[model samples]
Target: MSLTLYALGVAVLLSASFFYLFGYRSWRRRRVMAKPFPADWQTILDRDVWVYRHLPEPLQARLRPLIQVFLDEKRFYGCAGLTVTDTMRVTIAAEACLLILNLPLSFYDDLRAILVYPSAYRVPDIHREGEVLSESSGVHLGDSWQRGKVILSWEDVVAGAGHHQHGHNVAIHEFTHQLDQADGSADGAPMLRSSNALRTWSQVFSKAFDNLQKTLEQGHSELIDPYGATNPAEFFAVVTETFFERPRALHREHPALYRQLQQFFDLDPLSWTRAGD
Candidate 1:
């Protein structure tokens, strides 16, 4: 009996070790296989002169390969009588690449493809228990799901690329969701560099999120879209668009939040806008 018990314990330990080793190896392999955008991608992405002109040289260099991978791998379909053009493809690729530039390019390793529609599309509803209920129903301009796909409306993408404000860019919103998912969940928080940074991020975002919710409940004029108050994730994405598009307004109205976002993105759009102005 003693020998049998000892053998059983050893077998359990061996099994646990094997599982751990296998899991770690699988994770490492996936990380290694996540490719960086290729070098010659610019030849293809340069088709869109407008987008190409706006990109900074360093960013352009980094984004070329990523954009190429996006164009090659993703399927872009026209909906609602819309047509896809080189300009449209380049523009969309530029916006998506902006999120990956200056960050770990492999952060999006799991994102397999992007799907674009012509405009806001209606999702189907489900019938439940003799009651016709709107199930999976929403007028979506964009969405990022955990299953390695992102969906967007081309109209919203164009509007976001041009206007940057009005708090309704589906690209920024959905990409933000992608960033949130990098750490394996879409809980409105991305992986931080340090514990202290994480703490500060949580505090600042929580305060701002709560404030936005309060403003929405009170029905007061707000600097940000009220839809942001719907959740922390939405709040981060909404504020991100404002941070980039309407930097002056964001700074003037919510200086603290703006500062936090500046730190998070490591880009000072306010200064950039000011210089441009």
Candidate 2:
């Protein structure tokens, strides 16, 4: 064989060896990202996700990479004859990825599967009444489980994205719960797990929670969703919805709370909004 041919053969062997040493998943991730993003996916994003279109160029660049990795790694299943399509997956994945766009974390490391429902799905509603437990069922648009699962309703997901100013995204709400669960518990604060800026976060969130409860008791609830008063965990999730969907409103109504979320996510969503909106 010619010397050039022998060198080429040796290079191929070395490349294969490197790929094996690094891990197949990482190798495949590089390969997956090397390709151009599908134009059809961009069209779906434009139509389905209002936030995606408004994101600043830099953040937009950061997001596509995360979306690609999320779609590649996370598993999705259809429930109730949902027939989860690329549009659904892309819409949900885009919203979820937005939360983690600039933050440091695995792409939803603990999340292994997403169960998509055609609409609101029924779940067992267990309530405790001061030493009494009542068993009932309720319908939810989406939920995140600490044990590697997330469930979402396709219709609600679209609705949530459609009403971007409402700050009521099912995908964003449930995914925020997953972020809260990162510290091994859902106490409405994920800063204990992923952020060093804890003092301000604790001070602001605690005060805000107290203020919300007091205000609600006084029969005045605006500026934020009253459902956030449920608990710290739900509060965390709910505020996240507001933070992304209604950033300007949240910033105007509760600047301190918005700063805390901004600190944690390491991204200022206000930049994604319009000049005056």
Candidate 3:
């Protein structure tokens, strides 16, 4: 009887091991397949003239293929009487591509869908309060989920794209959240390449975040948007918009912060902004 029990236990262990290996192998295959964007996708990307014109030559080249992947696999939705237009699609794609232009294209592999609303729409029932309490109520311009969906308001998106100095771009802000979420948490820092880079990033961002918090507490108007004072994640996203949109002013006021962003993004928007057509 003892021998029979031991043999049965061994068989069960072997079966479990087989299932684990099979599941792991399947997951690995799917991950590898997700890396390469489909061919013939450039045609879809080329339809956008504004993105082609505004982005720098090097950035454009890098962005084209990444945007193609976004167009191919990502699902898009229109809600709250919103209509998804070609121009809106191009704008959102362009902004999102900017985030991954310098890094591996597979960084955004998990992203599978985009949902757009006509304007800021309310999300009812985020939490159950037994009485259906509408506790978290606001007009959100954009939101990114951990499960691969990005939500945006078309009106806010267009406005943000058109006005460079406003320090508000729903597309950039939500996609930045996606980047932060890539590491399974939406803490301030995203995945960096080297230890040195990580160290420098933490030090610079910590100091800047603390200062921004203090400035907000003091009830002072800051050069960067006060919304950045919301938290570390929002601060990173807000500063990113300023870095690209108002580079000269950011550099003049917060030189060290600008330098940190330059190292992280590996591009000088100040140069791009200065060399205007």
Candidate 4:
């Protein structure tokens, strides 16, 4: 062969090999991500994921793959001498996935790990206002951090999952905070699509939050948790719990706020029958 022909043949061979290797790696990565759903995890989901069982068949079908992805990606740590089991992981993943089921989600990209306790956990109740700091002991069911960690009590998780009628789910509450903190702050708002959407969100959220505070100040019971009046961040989390757990009440009491949440979440819980249905 001529020297030029030999050189060109070598170049073509190298190019073909490079493309083949790249394609193989891409296929391999996809296969790894598309791992088969585990039978034990499915059993756990069937038994412990109460909210999931209540979802419509279509929604459940849609959510199962996402739950699989979430389980595959995130890490779970047992705290307070608790041993994290497939049940714990599935239960937590199911509730957390419910929030993002109808929305575009990267599977809570900011969160790296979930820390669970066997029961209520204690933390330093440190209050920092400017330069002043006061420390005390406080008990919590669950808490989420901006630095990619969520702490939960497994007892609370089970209770919240099993009792959707109570409008209290520690898993839902804390994970909502994770979504709120996705944009670097747990300031009540999550990542929205546009400036206009943000403005609408601010107006609707601020008005409802103020009304909740007013109702609390008047010493009358409110439909949503009064703890929501704590701050905009907590208000968002607290109302989220109510929105999913007690959608009918939220809609009847705070129609505008419920509509806003419905728009943001892209789901209508009221349309579907509850667990018994």
- What are the Cα lDDT values of the candidates? 0.72, 0.85, 0.75, 0.86
Give the alpha carbon lDDT tens digit for every residue of 163-268 in model 4: 6868899999999999898888889998886888889999999999999999999999988899999999999999999998888888888888888888888888
TM-score of each: 0.74, 0.87, 0.77, 0.86
Instruction: Extract clashing residue pairs from model 4.
Output: none
By lDDT, the better pick of 3 and 4 is 4
Clashes of 3: 0
Which candidate model has the greater TM-score, 1 or 3? 3
RMSD of 4: 5.9
Relative to the unseen true structure, what is the C-alpha lDDT of residue 102 in candidate 1, on a scale of 0 to 100? 62
TM for candidate 4 is 0.86
Quote model 2's TM-score. Answer: 0.87
| Tens-digit per-residue lDDT, 45-121, candidate 2 | 88878888888878777778777888998999999887889998899889889899877545477888999999998
* lDDT for 191 (candidate 2): 46
- Where's the lowest-lDDT run of ten residues in candidate 4? 24-33
For model 2, the superposed segments whose C-alpha errors exceed 4 Å read 1-25, 192-196
Of candidate 2, the 10-residue stretch with the lowest lDDT total is: 191-200
For candidate 3, the 10 contiguous residues with the lowest summed lDDT are 42-51
Ranking according to TM-score, highest score first? 2, 4, 3, 1
Sort the candidates on lDDT, descending order. Answer: 4, 2, 3, 1
Which regions of candidate 4 are displaced past 4 Å?
Answer: 1-33, 129-131, 274-277
For model 3, the superposed segments whose C-alpha errors exceed 4 Å read 1-52, 125-136, 275-277
